[model samples]
Target: MDNVQKSMNLMGLAQRSGNLISGEAIVLNAVRSRQAKIVILASDASENTKKQFLNKCEHYSIPVRVDFDRNEISNAIGKIRTVAAITDGGFARSLQKLQ
Candidate 1:
């Protein structure tokens, strides 16, 4: 699969394994808690949200991807939110190239 398709599939796998956390705050919290393996932010996310998330990710050395738009990301993860974090092991490597 392509990058976008792989991301969507990985998101589905995360959801099935209950390793997905949606929304900025929850995802940020997961990152702060050192539970997040990778963070995915919508391309259309608000500037402040994006900036803050990026800053935190940088501070914590977490990998992040900004490939999909809000609708696409939300659709892929089955949420309306603009951000989501995967907390499962090995998931980060799957998204590394996108970071």
Candidate 2:
């Protein structure tokens, strides 16, 4: 599969298993709690949201990706307004290939 497809697939798996954090508050919580293995921010995410997530990720030494737009990210993660933080390692690895 292509990078986008791969990301979507991994995201689907995450969603099915209840491993997803789809909202801003939950994402921020995950980041602050340091439970995130990797942080994926939508390219079109607002500057403030992006900055917050990136800053947290950097503070925690977590890796980050901005490869896809909001639609692509939301589609992949199976949400409409997802804007920040954290995913399972497999998804993280798949996204890493795109980077």
Candidate 3:
């Protein structure tokens, strides 16, 4: 399978394992708590939203990925989310490897 498919499957696994958090408020909270190992923002997200997340992630010293668009991310985790966070180190490492 392609890298994109692999990444999406991994996201599903993460969600099933309850290690992925999505949505703005939840993800921000996770970042603040240092529970989020990686933050992913949809590449097609609005400029303002993108800026806000980028700044917040930067301030928290959290890693961020903006490789996928809204649809791709939403479909991957079976949620309509423009932002998501991987809380587990193993999942985060696996996802990063797909980049």
Candidate 4:
């Protein structure tokens, strides 16, 4: 499969395994607490939202991927969110590998 499809499949796995978290506030909290190993933000997000997430992830030393759109992400994780984070390092690394 293509990298994007693989990444989305992995996200589904992460969600099923309880290693992924979603929503803006919850994801920001996870980043602040260092629980978020990697963050995935929708590429189509508003510039303000994008800036906020990018800045926070940078400050926290967490990796961020801004490739997929909100629908793609929500479909992968089965949640209607524009932002999500992988809490498990293994899952995070797996996602990073797709980049």
**Prediction RMSDs, each to the true structure:** 1.5, 1.9, 0.9, 0.5
lDDT of 1 at 75: 78
Error of 1 at 53 (Å): 0.1
Best by lDDT: 4
Cα lDDT tens digits for candidate 2, 49-70: 8898889888988888777788
Span of ten consecutive residues with least summed lDDT in model 4 = 74-83
The lDDT of each candidate is: 0.84, 0.73, 0.93, 0.97
Residues 1-99 of candidate 4 have per-residue lDDT tens digits of 999999999999999999999999999999999999999999999899999999999999999999999999999999888999999999999899999
- The TM-score, computed over Cα atoms with residue i paired to residue i, of candidate 4 is 0.98
The list of candidate 3 runs beyond 4 A from truth reads: none
Query: Candidate 4: what lDDT?
Result: 0.97
Candidate 3, position 69, lDDT? 92
Candidate 4: C-alpha RMSD after superposition? 0.5
Q: Which candidate is the best by TM-score?
A: 4
lDDT tens digits by residue: candidate 3, 23-47? 9999989989999999989999999
TM-score per candidate = 0.90, 0.83, 0.95, 0.98
Candidate 4: stretches off by over 4 Å: none
Residue 88, model 3: lDDT of 98
| Model 1 TM-score, 2 decimals | 0.90
